[model samples]
Target chain A: MAAGNRRVDVEEVNGVTVAKFTDKKILDEGNIQLIGNQLFSLVDEDRRMKIVLDFSNVEYLSSAALGKLITMDKKVKSINGKLRFCSIRSDILEVFKITRLDKLFTIKENQEQALDGI
Target chain B: MRTLPSSKVMSSSDDLTEEFEVLIPSDTTAGHEVQERIIGHLQTRNYHERDVFGVRLALEEALVNAIKHGNGMDPAKQVRIYCRVDSIKIRIEIEDQGPGFQIEDVPDPTADENLERPCGRGIMLMRAFMSLIEYNATGNCVILEKGRTIEEAEANDD
Candidate 1:
């Protein structure tokens, strides 16, 4: 199934295709892989290069999920595409900060900023 | 008869020790369920949401490490978890049926040289979220603890 049909909702904002994850809690391992594959499908299966992940709804995500974000970033970078994240809750933001992934990814405070930055 | 995965929530008569234990195959789905259950119990106990999230994050990372890195995702292997919560703090122990790793050898994830690498963040996140983290001599078992002062717990209770 497509990301839009699954845990994420896909749309275009300022010409950037954004996948807003609907899942509020993302700590589960299967949810991690499902979201990862959903994001991957956006690049590999759907051929959409530039994307932003709107994490406004996610309260918590596991490190494995964070690892998937890294993998997604690498995948998009390999194809000269872009991927950004926005609306990360403070709790989830702590994970990014602690792991120092905040330095590696383009993290925005909101969807508009993510679209503009990406 | 085949042994199935099992989980239990136990509270001693004094209510000082609330513990849960689960034994499951090295499957991500099963691991996910156990993690959720543990977190749910913590939330029900009125742990601060942020603290609950912190422990939840650390717990999931440890479970992932035990299931994926430790057990190599072998369904035949088992990952055992024990979580104990009290007014003062919560403690969790995770052990995997796999060859242990060297703790000192695990690289620092926040180091500049390893910043972009995705492999080492789990341990770092676990350390950051939990107050104390200990690895067994063999490295197959990890003990994670986060403390809330009695005052803090009572404050939350109020």
Candidate 2:
């Protein structure tokens, strides 16, 4: 059941935790909440883990889902950990740009770029 | 998504008039139903891809505001949605039954001080994607329109 309800596929690469989302559209509130919890869990379990959120599969995202990412960023910052977003589609990237969150969080063009420094 | 949109009453017409009205309770299901219906109609018409994406985002935000913030998620209250979709243009209006607040009171989420704030970005996103977003005096109702022009769409592709 744990893997069944999980909206993200958590994988470790080069000592970094990469949570690749499985859903194409992250707009639904239920999936957003579950995704938030899973993202939070990565840090909650180990505060020092560097996290990379791969969004190549996400086609649609809502402001509510963005709200969750903001919260997760804060949580990671509180622990002095690194959290990055990568592989964002142009449209979803525009959402971050419009919200001015591109400045607030670390964003990269792809997972390779995200993991390069973090 | 917890709120999968409401599917109260969709007008069954043989014509391609993408106009329908839905009356939904505060349960948060009806709003999504309307969103799906409108987006599906837009896709079938071969609307611009960017327009379709933007419309879906703005519609999601507006519906959330109407159901969660406007109606306070009160099951007793009802939200009404009116939608009209045409080729390259769409108009949607959502009104909640709860007492409305002033639109001026919402803080600028993009401002320096409030940038980290998680809430209050719905209206901002709605305004950014939609060509026109006008709220009535009560702020309980919001009207959103997006008319994508050929030149503009080409410009966006650049």
Candidate 3:
């Protein structure tokens, strides 16, 4: 049997790529590696740099996962690409605010807005 | 299941009578859920909202460092957290089984070029969240303290 809660799906929309994470724990290294590998592959493929990480599927994120996102953003920017986030829950948003990362990333209310922002 | 460093362990015989313990698997994803549980516990004890937030952030940072850096994603290593809460303050100690590194070697996240980078911010956040942050001589143990007093917390708020 599979772990129903520990899944992540990556897809493309309107030339913008979206990584929808559905893991019970978003902070662990295994899950981080999954997202990181996919994002890295996207960068390598010369796919759309405008990326949207849909957190609506994630209940919570650990600092490690946040670090992974920051690293991914930097990696994308190095290749003339950008990464944005959308559909974040309020509780997780508070984590962003507390870490002052809310000021650094371009966060949108939904995937369409995130895609539009780029 | 492994025992923590002697200095980091606070047995019931210690001066502090109140203690809290939580066992979390040494996986990255477990960090957030454990953090939420810890914050929920703190709230039940009437900890100030801001203080609760601070403790949660600090714990998240430390636990990530332990699980990711210390344990290196090895599930065999477990993060054992022990906290002591008193009327005046809260002290949290986290231990990991991985070989430790020097605290001074970590780069400052606020440094100009590093500001845009992601990995080093955990230590910076930990320092900002706790009033007193220190590592045991072996470096496998980390101790973080936040004040419970109104004045101290207010000072931290700024």
Candidate 4:
């Protein structure tokens, strides 16, 4: 059951790193660290210009998750790469709005748009 | 209905002995998933939609504060959450390992000058989502309450 909850898949296309989160809750530091480390590793390996996060499977998002996104965005920017998001659920979108993060990052309608946006 | 002491609070009247405990890692990135599961559990038990969102927001803020402020993203420290539900209201308590800070030190997010800041909004959002928000003496424990109805609020007023 725990394994199922933490399932996350990563795929790279055209220098864009896309991570799909299947976990019902992104509530622990381990999951956050995994995502961060993955993004950093990808950036270091490909010198990728963009990173896309597909949150379609994520029904809910917390401030901690948002914090990680912010951290990732900064790390990517420092390396001259961009971080974009797509397929965010409406419930989780509300969290972005409440925190006024809707303006901080680039958000697209879907994975295709996220990759294309870059 | 008699108001129970803080020591014996339950999530709901249906299950008096079930204890709801959650451990949140010190990383801020994982807060979203944890918040969702907690809200889902509350909704499955018949909490109103508004209440579900309210609880989610409150829990998110509390856990984020614990991770970002309390634990400083140490990852080794954990944010422990305990909840009790009764027919009248739901009570949630969050404990962090870091030294407590004064509540007054947090700036109001709703204020005009601070609206644009990305941080400092968690506490304000938590207050809006729950009926009552209180900090324990050590400052690490935060207690929040959401009453089912106005009558329930009045009943538990004492």
Candidate 5:
């Protein structure tokens, strides 16, 4: 996407890059695509090996959004990187559990927990 | 014996069903608009927060599948949506303009081997959130339903 339309707020905590989603819905197809690109850039362009996805601002997300996360996870792994998700709402957490993505990804209750071992 | 007015009778009935139909172009933007309309109706009916959340998510997936997969994002094509939000249940049917698909052919996204795949989770999420989901024989149209317990609906049931 464009530099003006940043989809994530990226910060660094102890060498671990934290990318927090800025959108609340994460439903728009264009938005999801941009998010996917932005996330991929973290692994491919920025060469950030350790990452955490903060979902505190996300109130809703669709399967397309989930698809982006799956791809993001794969990209991180391809680089021998670590990615964790933190502060997912109960509803979205149910989605992860239902899709069994909870088992595939490292999910923690809060940013503190997610950053602890990473 | 006197009977209530037709509208009054409807209000007194066990279910207050509201029907909606809209034809949207083969674009996901249209999908978001329709989703908001349906979600707004459910919110007005005072559906439980979780029920609203699930419906919103399922509706999003179904619309994306119709516009992106079924319609192939062809602007010349259109998607037809028929919905009924009753007192206790919501039924939505979405029809697309592309060749039909076979639901049976869709691999299980949650399968052990497919866990890493990114694309095939829409159908799985729909089934997870909604009470029922079925595709027509042609697979161009899919039906989604959810049975929710809204407080006002429960009072009406009694």
Candidate 6:
């Protein structure tokens, strides 16, 4: 597998690293690990301190994926970086709300909104 | 209606009923294949994307709980999944061969003190997405159900 056969696509937009996941479904183990590794690599190699995850194409994610997100969020913060999400569907948004993570992260209505105040 | 032995797959397909069952080891990696199989079946049935995501997420959480929490990631243990689908509803039961926990004792992840915790969100996600979420008396088996509402069907048709 190529090194870039990653689950996330990182793009630098206006000084923010926008990582968009190509896969619609983020369940199962392999994809979750791929995502985790991608983000870890981003932080370690590219020195991306601010990230905006575009979840517009993603409809849902497993709890393990959820855990990975939490871990990633903490990882970014540990390095004094910022992490936010955009274009989250309602179904996945409900999970965030139920877990009260909505209060923890900055979720915007769309990518444009996520870019605001950054 | 009752539990069966390990490694038994009982499937039945008829005019009005569709059912599937599988027994898998505690390897979390296998969960992807199972989710794919089930979600593919649901898509063939013309379930909405939101509903598909909902079912997939719920089932993933259940399987993760069964593998990690219930079976303690023991490869020797197994997770049994039974799914029954009809025109009106879907019911999936995931059971693990491990010592069960008291469902009531689980701390609320949404609580003030627990808000930052990474675990305990699986159960909350299951309850949020599934129309009906129940556990067997032993708390090792979880039954998640979702009914297609008339409004949703109409919306899909529109």
> TM-scores for all candidates?
0.85, 0.90, 0.65, 0.65, 0.89, 0.86
Displacement of residue B58 (Cα, Å) in model 5 is 0.9
Residue-level lDDT tens digits of model 4 in B8-127? 333543563234666778865566666655665666567766677778778877877777788887878988878776545778888889998888887764455654444666676677
Error of 3 at B150 (Å): 7.7
Q: What's the DockQ for every one of the candidates? A: 0.60, 0.70, 0.26, 0.17, 0.82, 0.67
Which lDDT tens digits does candidate 5 get at residues A1-118? 5667899999999999999999899999888888889999999999999999999999998878888898899889998999999999999999999999999999999999999978
Best by DockQ: 5
Cα lDDT computed for each candidate against the true fold:
0.83, 0.86, 0.73, 0.71, 0.88, 0.82
How much is the lDDT of residue A73 in candidate 3? Answer: 74
lDDT of 2 by residue, B14-84 (tens): 45556777788876567777788888988898778888898999989988888888888988888889888
| Candidate 6 local lDDT, B34-55, one digit each (tens) | 8788777777777776788788
Over 4 Å off in model 3, which ranges? A1-14, A23-25, A56-59, A87-104, A109-112, B1-17, B20-40, B46-53, B67-80, B86-88, B96-100, B116-118, B147-158
**Which pairs of residues have clashing backbones in candidate 1?**
none
Query: Scored by Cα lDDT, where does model 2 land?
Result: 0.86
The count of residue-pair clashes in candidate 2 stands at: 11
Ranking 3 against 4 by lDDT, winner:
3
Clashes of each: 0, 11, 4, 15, 0, 0
Task: Tell me, by TM-score, which candidate is best.
Answer: 2
User: All candidates: CA RMSD in angstroms?
Assistant: 4.4, 5.4, 6.6, 7.7, 5.3, 3.8
Best lDDT among the predictions, by candidate number: 5
> Model 1 segments beyond 4 Å from truth?
A2-5, B1-13, B149-158
For candidate 4, the lDDT comes to 0.71
Question: How would you encode candidate 3's per-residue C-alpha lDDT over A10-76 as one tens digit per residue?
Answer: 6878778888877644655566777666666667775567778888877656667777777777778
Per-residue lDDT tens digits for candidate 4, residues A14-88, read 867787776666655566566556656656675766678888877655555676677777778888878889998
Ranking by DockQ: 5, 2, 6, 1, 3, 4
The window of 10 residues in a row where model 6 chain B has the poorest summed lDDT is B3-12
Q: Give every prediction's interface RMSD.
A: 1.5, 0.9, 3.3, 3.9, 0.9, 1.6
lDDT of 5 by residue, B53-72 (tens): 98999888888888888889
